[model samples]
Target: MAQIVISRFAPSPTGRLHLGHAFSALAAHDAARAAGGRFLLRIEDIDTTRSRPEHVAGIFDDLAWLGLTWDEPPLFQSQRMPLYGKALSDLKALGVLYPCFCTRAEIAAEVAASGFAPHGPDGPLYPGTCRALTPDDRAARLSRDAHSWRLDVDAALALTGPLVWHEGDRAIPADPRIHGDVVLARKDLGTSYHLSVTVDDAAQGITDVVRGVDLFDATHVHRLLQALLNLPTPLYHHHPLLTAPDGARLAKRHGAPSLASMRAEGVDPVTLVADLRARR
Candidate 1:
C-alpha cells in the first residue's frame, strides 16, 4: 500500500463557509479517512484587510455542524507571517524576487498601450518595467520609495528545473508567458496567496489537496513554489465548482447562500453530499 499521510482543507476566513466550502472540506476529510490518514484544517487568513476573527469562528461552527473535525488547533496564516517572511527571504537570497513599483493605474495604462491585457491571474499582466533595472537602480528605488516584491519566473525556473505538475490525468507545465512574474509580497501585505499557501501546505505536511477546478490553472504555479522551497507536491484533485443556475460560480460579494443559510433552511448534510456527488 502507498504511504498515506495527511490531507487538509484550508479556507480563508474572509467570508462564511458556503456549500462549495463544505464540499471541499468533505472531500478532503473523506479522502484522508479512506486512506487511513489524518485530516487538518488551516485558516488562510493572510488577507488581513478582509479576514476577520468572527469569520474564523463561523467556519469552525459550520464544519463542526457537518460532523467534520480537524486534527488539532487550526493553523492560522496571520500567525505564520514569520515563516512566510523566511520563505520570501530565501527566494530573495536566490535572486528570484524583485521589487515591483507599478501601481494598478500604471499597469492599466501599460495594458491599454499594449492593446491587450497582460497575462496573470488578475488579467492586467505586469509590464516588467522594473525587470530590467540594474542592482544599483533597484537599490536607489528601494532607498527612495516602497514597492512590492515579485517572483522572477526565469530565475526561479532556472533554479528549480522544469515547473510541471500532475493535474488529474494530465501533466501540466508552467507557462511563464501567461503566469509571468507573480507578486510574492505587496508593500502593505507581507505575503501573497501563492507564496503562503504553498508554504502552509508543506508546513502542515499535506499529502493530498482537495479544492475546486477553478484553481486547476494555479496548480503549476503551486508546484513551482513547492520545488523552490524543497517541499513535497501533494496529490491534487480539483473537483467541479458549484455554480448558479445561470452557469455562474458563487461569489462571496454576491451574498450567495452559505452552508449556514442552507442548514437554516433545513437542508441536511446528506443532501449537500448527494448534490455534490451527483455533479461528479
Candidate 2:
C-alpha cells in the first residue's frame, strides 16, 4: 500500500494573500487532492504584534476565492502556545539549547569586526558569542537581561548520528550548521519559527510540506529539530516561487498585487484557478 500524503499550506496572518501565496497553497491543495489524501490549513500567527484579525480573515477569504479548502478546520498557532512551550522545555532538558544574549546590533558588529561574515538562510550567521558563555556569565546575564534561546547545532548534531532528509527522490544530508545556532524561542514571543513550525507540523500529522524554494535550506534545521524531539520527518516539496514580470520573486515587499484586490476587481475565481493550473 502507498503512503497517504498529508500536506499543509501554512501562511502567517501578517498580510493579504498574493498570487505567490496562491501558488503555494494551490500546490499543496492539489498535491493532496491528486493523491486522494488530505490537505490542511495552518494559520501561522505566532507573531502576534503583526498578526491582525483582518489579515487572518483575508487569508480565509482569499483561499476560498481561489477555490481552495482544507480537509478540516484550520489550526491557529496562537491557540497552541502550550505545545510550543513543552517542545522548548524538552529541548532545554536535552541540554542542546542555550540562551543567546547577543542583540542584532552586537551580532552585526562582531561579524563586521571578524571581516568574514558567512551568510545563512536568515542573513549573516550569528557569531557564537552567547554559545561560548561561561555558566557564571550566562547566569549573570540571565538575572537581568532578556535573552532568546538558540539551539547549539554542533551539540545537537553530536547527539544525532548521520542524519538525512528527503525531498522528492533525493536524499539530502542534514547540515544544521548551515543556519548556525538557530533561535528556538524568543523572550517576547516565547517561540521562534524553527521551533513552532517543527512542533506544529508533527502535532498536525503533516506527511508532506509543500512550500517555496526559499525555505529549502531551512529544512536542514527542521530535520535536526525532528530528530532531537523524536518527531516524524515529513517529505518536503520546495516548489518554485511565482515571479513578477521583471524576474523578481512575487512578494508583498515588492508590491505584488493581492488576491483580495483581484477579487474586488471582478476577477473570476474559477478562471484564476485555471490560469494558475495551466502555468503549473
How many steric clashes between backbone atoms does each model show? 0, 0
Off by over 4 Å in 1: none
Query: What lDDT does each candidate get?
Result: 0.83, 0.93
| Per-residue alpha-carbon lDDT of candidate 2 for residues 1-280, written as tens digits (9 for 90 to 100) | 9889999999999999999999999999999999999999999999999999999999999998888889889999999999999999999999999998888888889999999988887788998999888999999999899999999998899899779999998999998888998889987898999999999999999998999999999999999999999999999999998997799999999999999899999999999888887777
lDDT for each residue of candidate 1 in 1-280, tens digit (9 for 90 to 100): 6777688988998889987787778888888898789999999988889989899999998998888887878998889999999999988888888998888888778878988765666576687888988989999889877799998888888888876676656677766546788888988888998899999998888888888888877777788888888898888889887777887786676666898888898988777777775665
Supply the global lDDT for candidate 2: 0.93
lDDT of 1 at 190: 86
Model 2, residue 259: distance off in Å is 0.6
The candidate that wins on lDDT is: 2
Query: Which sections of candidate 2 miss by over 4 Å?
Result: none
**Could you tell me every candidate's TM-score relative to the true structure?**
0.93, 0.98
Task: Point out the worst 10-residue segment of candidate 1 by lDDT.
Answer: 168-177
